[model samples]
Structures are given as structure tokens and as C-alpha cells.
Target: MTDRLTIRRPDDWHLHLRDGEMLKAVLPETTRHFARAIIMPNLVPPVVTAADAADYRDRIMWAKPKNSDFKPLMTLYLTEDTEVRDVRAAAEIGLIHALKLYPAGATTNSQSGVRDFKKVTRVLETMAQIGLPLCVHGEVTNPEVDIFDREAAFIERVLDPIRREIPELRVVMEHITTKDGVDYVAGGGDTIAGTITVHHLVINRNHILAGGIRPHYYCLPVAKREEHRIALRAAATSGDPTFFLGTDSAPHTDAAKLQPCGCAGCFTAPNGLSILAQVFEEDGALDRLEGFVSEYGPRFYRLPLNDGTVTLEKGPPVEYPAQIETGDGPVTVFDPGMPLYWRVVD
Candidate 1:
């Protein structure tokens, strides 16, 4: 058994709450545990414009479980033609907490993403001027590039250039997967930060292929080798503000996931914190868990930390439900399927 401890209420630095009924269903789990979440903008049509972002924010607020203060910090989806004006106005209105950069064809609805990073140079300049952070998908999509190599290649080809051009930009390299990514974010000056997912910290590519195709474990910026997973663990628990938590807890229906060619995502919001605490405990970094989960992201984003605290006790393992019923079909939330030692206490 493990001892109990209290930590500042953690914020989920990355999350995807799909729209409408799906949104209403999974949102409560996230709000119950996290104080705030940086909401992803990769909806079907995407939330590229400020109007779209504002409209979506209203929906999230409306869908939120009654009396819950789970603040959904919105992000603008970047497109090739995303205007500098929209970027500034969104941030200025306090509608967009950050701007998301998804290279076209990189992930799910990211087909509407930006085709050329350089083309958005003007918009980036304005973002630098306004102090809005750029949260990136961080993967390249050239057909010839190996799926495993996309993220590393992107760091060299796209991200480095953006870093040079927008020197003042506060960027979060979303869902980092490899040693190179860990090195870049950890080594870069204070302005560079990255969100590491629970899957990345706990499992690797082999774990996905471990018995058979484990579609639920799959996600874009796909898991890397065991070595990278180790590097990710080091980065996550290193007690660095540049390294923090972002579950990237994206969900897809079970039928969609179990099909011949399943969708990319993991519905982890429900068990995200318990799994995180388990990872930190395994790394013998429970003392450092509080910083990664609760402190660093807010400090880097310049937001005030929540005054509330949550206590997760070392008790009986949690049994996460294997599937959830959705409007179209059942959806599978990512379940590591073990005795989860750390569970949230009421």
C-alpha cells in the first residue's frame, strides 16, 4: 500500500471533447478531476476562426455538468489561410487560451490544418506580439516519411524554423514522443514547453502490438520505441516546468476503433489522473508528481494556479469500465487493465 498525499488541483493541459452528445457524455469525467483543460480544436470542420472558437466554447460551457467550474480554455485551429487578425482578436477577447498548429493531414480532422508553416509567418508574428502560445501537433505528413519518423523530422524541418522566426512565441510541443522531442523541449530556453501524455509515459509502440493490434492504445504522434518511452518518463517527472501533463485524451467510438482501419485517439479522461499517479509512483517520483500535474503548465501559460487541492490515496486498484455507450455505438476508453494503485478520494 502507498501513503496518501494532497496536491494542488491539476489541470489537464491537453484534452479533446468531441461535440454534441459525445461532448456531454465524456466531459463530466474530466471536469470532476481537472481544474482546467486546454480544449483541442480539431472538430469535423475545425475551429479555425474566432467566431467558431467562441461558438464552441459556449457549447462546452453549456454541456458542462451542473455546478462544475471546469474551465475549458479554447484554442484556435490553424489553417494555411488563418488570418493574423483572427488570431489577435481571439486572444484579445480572451476566447483563445492558446493557438493550435496542426500540419495538414497530420491527424484526425487535421485535414483542414495549415499546409505551410512559413505562409503563416505574419499570423505567428502577431501571436508573438500578443503573447498567445502556439500549441502544436508536431508531426510532418509527407507520404515518403516513415510514420514513426514524422515527429522527429518535423522538429528539424518545421518547428525549428518557426522557433527561429517567432523568437518570442511561447510554444507547447503537444504530445511529445521521442528522445529528440524530449531533448528539444527540455533544452530549449524558457519559452519552449511540451505536454507529455500518460500513454507515452507508461507504454511504447510494442505495448500497442503486444498480443495483437491494440487500437485503443493508438493515437497520432504515435507511440515510439521503449527507449523513447523511458525518455518521456524522465521528461515528465524531471520536475521541469517545460515538461507537464496533457492527456491528449481524445476519444472515438468502439465501432470506429475496432474497424479494419480504426481511428486515432484514446479516451483517457476518466482514468487519466489515476494512471498518471501510478506512473509517477513507479518512477519513484511521487514527490515530483504534483509539479508535473498541477504546477508547471499554469506557470508556463501565466495563469493563476487553482487554490483547491485533491487527494489521491494509495488504496484498492480502480477498475475502469471497458466501454461506454455512445449515440452511434459503444466507445472504448483507454484502460491499462491492471490494479491501478492510486485512486482519487472523495
Candidate 2:
């Protein structure tokens, strides 16, 4: 049996490296394995302008480990007042890679997100003209829509209309958790793609709510039903260029996560690659793992493939820390529940 595999170093198409202490703690987990990542923009105040993006990028750089060549592709948070000129300038200078769309109140720290899509038509048009992608947290905040149905609702009510209006606009639907999401991106032509998180592919709603509420498994665009999980697994392992890896490795302190109104996210960065390797191997798609993790993301972003390589060696069940300590507190690493037999040996 094949025991070892190597591929181009991976890139995280969607990631959340929160500022300050959290950033310092989690940055290395990703940089150790990934060559680059498209950093999320939904900070407390949010990275709303070119200046805000620049400042946040600087902080990320400072937090990065010494001599690590990991590149942080920054993004700006899209709000109603986001200026077209600022986005154009950010794109032109390579200061930002994309702009994130969070329907206001849709998730954590999204209070400043867009309430009316009409207000951002000029910005969207400018993005389409300039070829900058819009990375979206694909969920609707409408109270009436069931949490499980939000992603499907978003495609029909929000994403489809936006894409139809601006056909040239490139979009990366970040951390998609539903079959509806997979089907939409599969049918969406080259202009659109989707990012599936490692956690979603491994755990379904049962992992979160079956016996009790497991807060760490709890994440925004929260895990859906088992059938949807099967669909996500098929799409991810299919080696389709329209889908790729974006471990929305959001880290929240155990204190912050285990509360009455706990925050939404999974700290998957620490064990992300190992879990991915296990998942791919279990599906008999070992040959396609590299394409999912390292190849398709850069091709869609129009970035060069990474020169270096990382190798995974299969073995007995690998052990990873249940929680990683940070200045803030202990952040729980994602537990895929199933024992992983692959480890990044290199």
C-alpha cells in the first residue's frame, strides 16, 4: 500500500487570523504547512478600507514566525460605504486580494456588514472590472430562515442575483457547508468557486447536536445534516477545480467558546492537513488530495503554485493536542472524532 505522498505546499483560500494574541498563536499552525493563505477581514471593527487592510496585514506579518515565508493575502470587509476607488487601489497595488461580504448580523463581528446590497453596486462593478474576487460568508441572517437552510437561501436570494447582475465578478463562496452550496458552485461556471472546510467534510450536525452541544464543533454556517456531509465529501474528493480547501480555522478561547452565547468557529489550523490526508485516504482519493489542498485554490486565484513541498506519511493513529495554549487562553484544536492515521512527515 502507498504510505507516503508529497505535493505542492498548500494554500488556504479562506482563513481567519484574528488580530493580536489570537493571531500570534494560530499563525504558525498554518504557516508550518501552508505556503500562503487568503486572510479573512472580519475583525471587531473589520478591515473596511485599503488603509485598514494594510494595517491589519502589518500586524499579521509581525505575528508571523521568524524566517517563515508564509504570505498573507489580505482582504477588505465590504460594507455599504466601501469606496470603489479604495478597492481599486488595493487591488492594483496587491495590498488586498479580495473583499468579504457578510450579511449584517450573519456571524461574529459582522455588525458593520452590508445591509442593502444596492449600496455596493458601484463597488461590485469596480471589482468585476478589476478582476478582484468577492469572498463571501454564504449565509442569510433573516430570522425566519432556518439556520440549516440559510446557505441554500443565500444562493437563491443573494448570491444568484449578485452574480447575474455582475457576470464578470469572480466569487469564492467561503466555507460552504451544504449540498446546495456544492451544487451551486458545480453549476457555476469558471467565474465562481467554493471553499469547503476540513471540519464540515468530517463532521455533520450530529457531531454538534446529536447527544449534546459540542461548542468546538459548533461553527458558523454550522454543520448540516449527514446527507449534505456526504455530498461535500464527494465534491471535495472529486478533484473539481470549482472547489478547494479553505479551513476557516477560526480560534476562540475555550472560555469564549463555552458560554451561554458562545462564539462560532473551529480552530482547525493545528491539525488541518493531517485530518485532510486521512479524509482523502479513507475515500480512496489519495491521488486527488494534492489538487484539493494545494493546486486548485491558487489556480482559481491566479496565483503561482508554491515551489516547496510537504509530505505526509501514513501510519498508526496520530496524536494531536486537544487544545493549543495562547496568551488569551487555551484554544481547542478541531477534533475530527475519527482517529487520523496520516501525519505530515516533512
lDDT of 2 by residue, 72-123 (tens): 9999999999999889988999999999999999988999999999999999
Task: Give all candidates' CA lDDT scores.
Answer: 0.88, 0.93
- lDDT, candidate 2, equals 0.93
Assess candidate 1 and give its TM-score to the true structure: 0.97
Quote the positional error of residue 129 for candidate 2 in Å.
0.5
Q: What are the models' TM-scores?
A: 0.97, 0.99
Pairs in clash, predicted candidate 1: none
lDDT per residue for candidate 1 within 47-123, as digits (tens), equals 98999998999999999989988899999888788888878877887888888999988998888888866788888
Q: Name the 10 consecutive residues with the lowest summed lDDT in model 2.
A: 208-217
